[model samples]
Target: MKALIPTGDPAEPVVLADVPEPVPRANEALVKVEAFSVNRGETFKLEAPAPGDRPGKDIAGLVVQPAADGTGPAGIARVVGHPMAGGWAELAAVPADALAVLPDTVSALQGAALPLAGLTALRLLRTAGPVLGRRVLVTGASGGVGHFVTELAAAAGAEVTAVTRDAARGARLTELGAAAIVHDPADARGPYDIVLESTGGETLPVALARLARRGTLVWFGQASRTPATLDFFDFFDGPESAVIRHFHYLDADTGLGDDLAALVRLTAEGRLHPEIGRVADWADTATVLTDLRDRRIRGKAVLTLS
Candidate 1:
């Protein structure tokens, strides 16, 4: 099998190389690589791709090698429920219990887009505290996770306010259900029920100040490539709190299936529309990695195998 390794060296660490195939263990499944996508949100921003270090985390593949142990039979791994080494090559070994059954309507390329970004969006939607008819805001609305958050919020009947940096992309964000699209959230008067933040830095403080009293701020990944900092006074500015809360997806202890369930239902029903930026083959994993790090991607960048 071939894999793109993320080394400490950014200039040359991400090149591809052929490696031995992995075998499934008890409670594990060897996924015949079908599709995988890039996550420039966290891991890549921290370190460059090194040898043997696969950077892509989201995957969509078939179960070829099931575990010999009964702990897993059809061998499936989940998107973010567990820490599977991640999907970035021709084959990936994951715990059988982790994967969810893919419906016929969703393609492998689409499945790969679901796991991480989808789950993160789910968690944010839940953290948003319900949107039956409330107005909500989603920052970074055109990117992968942002798109999910935007669509999920809209389908739930909330008037979604999407914040985007580019004008051309802002036009399309309206198609995703954004009531208003702009380069910055500061331009909008909020008092929103919830705001999901993918863009970090000074903007986080600004988002909080715009929140309604008792409003919640559900933030996850930071894509601004700036160190995250916040003023406690700013968070407590509202009659209750300008920013009532915060959340983290990188923490391994949080359980988010309820959020994922919400996403699965919407996806299964076709209420949610997934926007794929570009689809690449498994052999092109290195290119996907480079494109994401360089921020050249238009939407979700996926690598397909099957």
Candidate 2:
């Protein structure tokens, strides 16, 4: 089998090489991968490549073999999955619980784009509780998860303020459902009921100060790669009982399959759109990773198998 393996070199982080095929566990299903999406975090890992680092998490494929434990979809189901690693391969052993059958309306490319970003947006909204008629702010509102957060938050009736420096991307976000767009988080008006922030660094404190009373700030990523500094005085002037919560997509109490199914359903219903900014052959995975790391791609980047 051929898979992308880390080469331990910064310039050429990964290379397609012959490797042993994965053997699925009893609770896992073997999928013949059709497409997979590249994420920002994965590109960071690629920068400091390790010998055994496998760089893939989102995959869409056909279930060639079901779990031995009799879980997951039975009989050659078309599915999207969130695997721990190695999803870039021609085949992946995915946990049954993380696999969701995709509707015919959803393409493999869309499915590959859903698991990480879509799940994060869905769960972030869930953590914020009821968003109807609330004020929500999403920093780093131009990326994959941010795009989903903007659309989902707006669809739930929240007055969404999306922060992005790009005018073109902001216009698209408005079309997707953002009520307002700002070039920076500092430019956004405050008293927000919920804030989904991921840019980190100076942006985190600015977004935090905008929270309303009892507001929840869900911090998920630090795309800027800079550390945030906060002063106690900054919090003193903020709303009462403001909460800052760290979010991990895998921390949900619900199974991934259920949430993935919901995302696919929404896509099928034309409510949620998977924002795929780049599509290329798996042969160009290295180039796609570089584009993602350099922030050249707008949203999600999907690689199709030839």
Q: Which prediction has the highest TM-score against the true structure?
A: 2
Error of 2 at 148 (Å): 0.8
Q: What TM-score would candidate 1 get against the native?
A: 0.86
- In model 1, the worst 10-residue window by lDDT is 75-84
lDDT of each: 0.68, 0.92
Tens digit per residue, CA lDDT, model 1, 1-306:
777666565544355667778766776777776777666763463364333455555766677776667644364432322224646677787666555556666676677777778877776676667798998878877788878877778877898888887877777778877888868878867878777777788777787777777777777756786766877765655537455456755453344334444455677788876678888766665566667777777668877664
Number of the top-ranking candidate, with lDDT as the measure: 2
Q: Number of clashes in every candidate structure?
A: 11, 0
As for candidate 2, its clashing pairs are: none
- Candidate 2 has its poorest 10 consecutive residues by lDDT at 6-15
Quote each prediction's TM-score: 0.86, 0.98
| Tens digits of lDDT, candidate 2, 1-306 | 999887766556678999899999999999999999989888888777665878789999999999999999985999999998999999999999999998888999999999999999999899889999999999998999989989998898999999998999999999999999999888998789999999999999999999999999989999999999988887977879888999898888898999999999999999999999999999888888888888899999999998
